[model samples]
Target: MSQPGPGSNHAPPAARTSPESGPPFSEAGGIPVDAATPVTTFSPVVLEVPGRPVDLRMKVSAPATGDNLPVILFSHGHGPSNFVSSLHGYGPVVDFWAAHGFVVIQPTHLDAMMLGLREADDPDAPAYARSRVEDMRHVLDHLDQVEAAVPGLAGRLDRSRIAAVGHSMGGHTVGVLAGQSTADPADGSDLDLSDDRVKAAVLLAAPGHGEDLAPAVAEHYPALKATAFHGMTTPALVVVGDKDWNAHFSQRRDWHCDAYSRSPGPKSLLTLFGAEHGLGGISSYDAKETTDENPERVAALRALVWAYLRSALYPGDRAWADATAALAAMATPVGAVESK
Candidate 1:
């Protein structure tokens, strides 16, 4: 994979000191904030999947200048949200990854609340979880066209270094791509949707196994009963909030860490001190969904995830090492990292 070479021209503007004066900025892990590459975004890059009812629309963001840039396929979480589930959400993480030398492609899944489609509307609606995985696969299959749709991004992506990231239900979406297996709830047959193309993954506040789910979850999201992670062999980092207790999902908040504990080796877990499902407002700048709206926390999360991605993709990069060390060295650490 091509790494960021030394050049001041790619640097983003210095972060402002006054909180009220400008947008909040977080320090980049391993790389100096001013030394990271600038970003450019192209939105609503539409692609059609044969036999699908709706065209897949995506938002692509990349460094303003660079070649062989790594790709991050981000899946937006399902919510009663309108625009967030579309190509318009998660600006915070998407922009950060792009500005720091990644090509982030975010696709709106069919389960998006914005679509206002109901399970009773179609046979596939009951298989929304599976569709999320297929949406990502479609994105990979049409990477050439997606890149072509965005000027200056064409021919600049490193296809070998792709990572899948998701939040909430989106987490389950990327989990499947990362090797987690599930059974079709309707037929009780194994559903192996893993994609080898995704070299790494990050699951944020993802759901746990079905057997351990809270009673409410089993009653409502019955499809989760088939979730299984024993096959999630890809290198991944699972980030969960210490306070992200979803009474409707699991009896215990730590249940969210199943993706880390149950997955095979070469995995890491990040336990954020006071974070919730939103993980310090990663979904948006100031969306009401963020119960813990700490910019500092969001910054740390971004840096740590970026560092892990850097190390996992490049092999020789010590970004993860430096980032973990930085976190450990903090006088009052915001989180803890453990790997096996």
Candidate 2:
């Protein structure tokens, strides 16, 4: 479904948030929630992967009390901060999703600065790209151990229902999980790692069809320079800041929408006006990386994400439909949800 064009529609979700309101994420637009569960966070859920550069360390967050909870495998972006790229970061996003009843899992990928495991410090290294995807897979393959590691989490997770989410470079990982394909710049072999286990995804500020990369991006990040989403058959909601433009990455900002536009339908796009790469501080709360910091915007993001995943995972749940309707009810929504 073509999303109700962000600024183009006049319906309730149509009130384009001016630059003042800020941008992005899933808090159900303007829906109301009476209460949220308390969250519990566990860190250093170590996984032993022989032959791997380092022991895979991860963080897991979930409601203090819940049963049959769905899981969200969240991938952190390669931010400049020392910790934002680690499992310790993304507090704003992890806490929100966990409190809203998701078992959130975050892995410290090889690209994280704290590990410094990669031979090259380059954030866009192809090796990091491949390792990140494997990290998530490792988590999935060892779900029994992961659940056992987190106190009070075992037997609560609804293993059948799983979704993947990522931001920026992490989004590239989610893209691959959703079946996005591209050539390994080094060997020219196809790199496709789509997982049948992931039912859905939400990619934030993800790179698009890589047709127009900046000069530096082409030379430095060849793996990203040729990303293609034609095989991304998984259903996903692609969230992007209307202003997430970085000349070092691409000549066009809409390149982030390729996950939605270039892929098939059963997808939606949440366009935040005046929002930048950080998508209103999603990487970390009150961090220096967020150029568009706004508590209200982040709140909206939390609600929308919960509702989207809630409905997607549950057969009878109306959270997404209701959330979108709630957004349509708002006269000045921060953004609009257009589905095609």
Candidate 3:
């Protein structure tokens, strides 16, 4: 697919911040450290969203294995859980990425953080989705501050190569963060896209919460309805399974494939063979256990994720893609392999 170049949609990088000027992941909710530690200390922060203090958990990556590693700002799936989903809930995806050489930060958009006193008063009020996206920006800004605090951290993070990856509601959040505007999930209204810090995004099983996929009636998020993500122009990749109930996995796959086709930049889609809504099959901590059950399947899926991450983090590297493609195709019947 045609992935978007550095300067595709939105304003030029000059309009954004430059390395000499400031830090890239700063404002966003990430911390930067110089020492060699696997996990940075956790700091509780309160971000102001329309005069409201939103609680957030922030952390930075340990020392990188290579020089000038790319940064990935991850948004966890919106379940009752916090950023835990990105860390321990799902497979060791985040850990794998970190081990490979990428700074990963996950923001937990707890409803309590934004609901405030009105949470009980407005029983019918829709949960704030926009706030979640903005929170991501806050995390980035915080990372920028970390750079200011610690030297040699400024240029290490390449904001231009930054990417946003999310699952479920988090996927939708990344969509909005990357410029995919849709109607509000609660009311049929347009959503605001004020903060466009994310340059590229990867949507995994993104829910069409407010979509009217059913011809008769359309669901919408009043605060976010009537909004359409235009000129996203950033390179994106959308992955989905075949058994996910939310988007019927297959439907989601088709939707993402179409989205990639419409995107201004290069894009690709990978449908896990018989995968389900919950990556229960592949998202596991025990690589050995999963591999034991189906080594071929696990290997293929790992190659897929590793290849994509490699390309996304280090653009212009086609070797990873080539190797992964060969690995994936090596297995029999294209989409018949088990995820686990």
TM-score of each: 0.89, 0.88, 0.65
Candidate 1 ranges with C-alpha deviation above 4 Å: 1-25, 28-34, 123-127
lDDT of the candidates, in the order given: 0.79, 0.78, 0.48
lDDT of 1 at 98: 88
> After aligning candidate 2 to the native by TM-score, how far in Å is the CA of 3 from where it should be?
34
Best by TM-score: 1
Count clashing residue pairs in model 1. Answer: 0
The candidate scoring highest on lDDT is 1
* Tens-digit per-residue lDDT, 270-323, candidate 3: 666555443432334432212122333444444455556666666697734564
Model 2 bad stretches (over 4 Å): 1-29, 118-127
Per-residue CA lDDT of model 1 for 213-236, tens digit only, reads 766556455567778788999999
| Better by TM-score, candidate 3 or 1 | 1
lDDT comparison, 1 vs 3, better candidate: 1
The residue-by-residue lDDT of candidate 2 on 131-202, one tens digit each, is: 788889999999999999999998999988999999887888888998988666457578787898999899
Candidate 3 clashes: the total is 40
